[model samples]
Target: MADTYKFRIDHHGSLIRPAEVLNARARHAAGELDDAGLRAVEDEAISESARQQRKLRMSVVTDGEFRREDFRGAVLDTVGGFRRTGGTDKYGRAQWVADGEVKAGGPLIADGYDGVKAMAGTAAPKAGLPSPAFLAATCFDREISGAAYKSPVELGEALARIIRDEIELLISRGIRLVQLNNFRYASYLFSRGGQPLTLDEAIAVDSIAVDLTAKPEDVRIGLCPTHQVTGTVDRDAATRLFAGLPVDRWVLPYDKGAEGEADLLRAVPADRDAALGIVDPATAELEDVETIMQRMDAAAELKDIENIAVSPSAGFADTAGRAAISADDQRRKLIHVETIARMCWGNEL
Candidate 1:
């Protein structure tokens, strides 16, 4: 491993899309715009998003996942062979049935990475991929997916290969940071439905998905829960999950800064860092910097300040127009994270 990897301040991948981008998407869906035409608009929006992150002095920058309808939609959009069922999941998400063998149709996030790299002035470009666990759990159905694979486990392994291929291409393009949006873990924590894998199985699948053997030494990997997980977590499960994945950090939610939450920091392996999610993205209210600093202090008391950071609880917009917060509110929340980091770690951000 490299000596150290730290991100004093960061945000989940998605950002609120500007009105123009949304309109372009709507037009494209209606067959009013061609692929090239839609891409031009997306590229400009991504460039502007990168500039905004650089302006805020973010420790890491993303393409805002502007090209994707949802954060996890990338795999389904690029990889072929998933048959859409006219049904929705418990969370109102469109369901997909794995009926045929899957293969990468084209570049997944590399194009977006290129856009961020072009405009990321002083920050590292981060590409977030949905965890194979989450994709398999949510997309695979026992009866419908049986034609492609025997079980969701087999389907997950297949998706792991596809995602790994995408990761390899990204690394070849000089990406240093890759975060797996491992939202399925939240299912285990919150007892949500549509999850087929147990905690151990999900962890095992995640392990296979990120097994990068020859990546550069400084290429850091992280895990971020796409949904909010509040209150207490099972310490044993947390410890296994943190230590099991070969990642550099874990971005966890602490929206309410609930009692004994800081103690969960101990679950993170000493070798891995933890970025506390103190700023809530679902609401428009700005968080108190003093309260954010207090939460950071509690975490610092458990883990080294050098191994801690701050971020929004989740993406500003997992799906387009999903988050209730406006663009201005989103900026202020990110600024609060940056301000809190500066107070805790000086200019380390």
Candidate 2:
């Protein structure tokens, strides 16, 4: 609670990966390109992405998550002990079971941070880590992970430790803003969908993950809730996550409409920032800036304008080569967020 989290304009971490990065990844997967060659392509693309965010004057900048296939790739690709089941879960996410202890193979997303740090001159570099609760729900297979982890909670605890390590590494490298991408709580707890962990259990799992060793003031941790495609939170779940979690920011989904989410918006702690998902990222249509400002005005009524932030409903690209919005659309959407923030909060943005 250092009160250091000041970003009033934000976006979900992932941005659309350019074609060359995706093509290079395909070539690397096919053994046609080596690691160094693939990284070179990724680096160039990430540099451009950082430059664009800096250009947009976003207070917080990410590497566009270009190094990751999906946001979870930061952990799934770098961490060891997961065995691919060659199939997807009910949610359509690729299944990676815990065959052994979950542990990091090396630094997770450090290279991406390096790329951001080198290019994001004045903006605070942000790191996107997958939520342990989300990972546990999606990746923990009762049959496959049973030998390695007695329960989904057990797997989640392991993931929490690994994520804690990554957070430590990130803070040490001077990265201050860390956002956890979560969907499980919204899907199961908020929407009342069937799931492995209860809402309380999901929050407990995530709490363990963000129980960082670094000084709480040293890093600004946020949680962005998104369904695979579209989702929203019930008041109870929103209240629980916003009040119970130790994180400093909550990037909530409001693309469906802010009126319905007004009560949930009240759940955010006064000390934490509420980043409204005013623009829908799953569509190409740019949000009307006036309408977005009205939403911000509504949010301001519930919380201080300093505590209000704005972002897209979700990431532009959750996976490679599968963004619903065009590059121009993504840029415009972010610009809309910036514009809305300025109009609503003025110089605070």
Candidate 3:
């Protein structure tokens, strides 16, 4: 496939909005805010999120996952064979993981692309889904998932099928970019710490899972891999796992220095592009364009500059309740990417 985009800057699905969403959700749950009132607030926020992305001159605009309470809640609730089993985290908040069969049910994502049009009115709307591999990796409970699935392999494949259906639905609606949110598990597989599933199988499974909708030329299929592989494992073999997949771009994470990034850059397939996560989301300090340029320059040293795009290390809102950076900081982070990229690419886009 020829390059679908020419040196553009955009974000993964979520955005950093004010605290209205979290507050509204709680109010609605407590019956203080009616469903209609909560929805009105969310709709307004989605519009604002899209408007912000457009203001940045982004090639893609996201609806900011404003409609969902948490990232995984969409698929876990709708999908068959999953029930919220009782659990809690270290924070003492009630927690739950899907414990059931991997059968199909409701749409994995409610339409953010359409929301962009009705609210923000942007032409470049990106529709993202939690990667099929994500459901496979996180939902594997032997006593729970195994009861429904013959084995872990079957659970993974079932997840791929359901996600394929969702992608096809999105493509049919003319949503062009389908971002598969692997949430860093793809890179973690290569790290020295042992991963439950084999790296080879994970790649193959994800490839089968996301190779949906339009031809690769027509659709921009992006993989958001967050972890930077560490030295405890075979970086050579692990890096090469990116070879010959249907994916169009690798939105890879880069939080540390650029020294170890060469092997990962070298591993990118000839046909695909690499989008570097330059800004660290864990901190709120705003980086100047020159700081972003430093990372771009480092990547250029490893590979041709044309194969790259730049973004933050993760979504601006790390969790629904937590904005990793202030909204102003997020805007600066995105603006720095576009401004620096323009300086590097002759100020065209």
Best by TM-score: 1
Q: Write the per-residue lDDT of candidate 2 for residues 1-349, one digit (tens) a residue.
A: 5235677678888999998999999999999999999989988888889989999989888988888878888888888878678997564667777777888877888755778888888778888999998888888877778888998999998898889888888888978788998776666435767889887888889998886655546468888765332335476777777788888888777665534467667878887777778888888787776676777777778888776777887888887788887999899888888887788767754
Residues forming the 10-long window of minimal summed lDDT in candidate 2: 225-234
The TM-score ranking, best first, is 1, 2, 3
Shift in Å, residue 98, candidate 3: 3.8
Please count the clashing residue pairs in each candidate, in the order shown.
0, 0, 0
Off by over 4 Å in 3: 88-96, 118-123, 184-190, 227-233
lDDT by residue for model 3 over 1-349, one digit each (tens)?
A: 4244663575777776558888998998898999789878988888877777777877677778787645555566467776555775453423544466566655666454566765434445677677666667666777766667755556777778887888787677666676777653544535544554566656667777777654544667788765454543345554655664577787776556555555666677767888777767657776655666776777787666776777776776635766756777778778877776678787664
Root-mean-square deviation per candidate: 1.9, 2.1, 2.8
Q: List the residue pairs that clash in candidate 2.
A: none
Q: List runs of model 1 lying over 4 Å from the truth.
A: 1-3, 190-194
Candidate 1's C-alpha lDDT?
A: 0.79
TM-scores for candidates 1 onward, in order:
0.94, 0.93, 0.88
- What is the C-alpha lDDT profile of model 1 across 257-340, one tens digit per residue? 776355456778777887778888988888877887777777877887777777887889988867788899999889888887
Which of 1 and 3 is ahead in TM-score?
A: 1
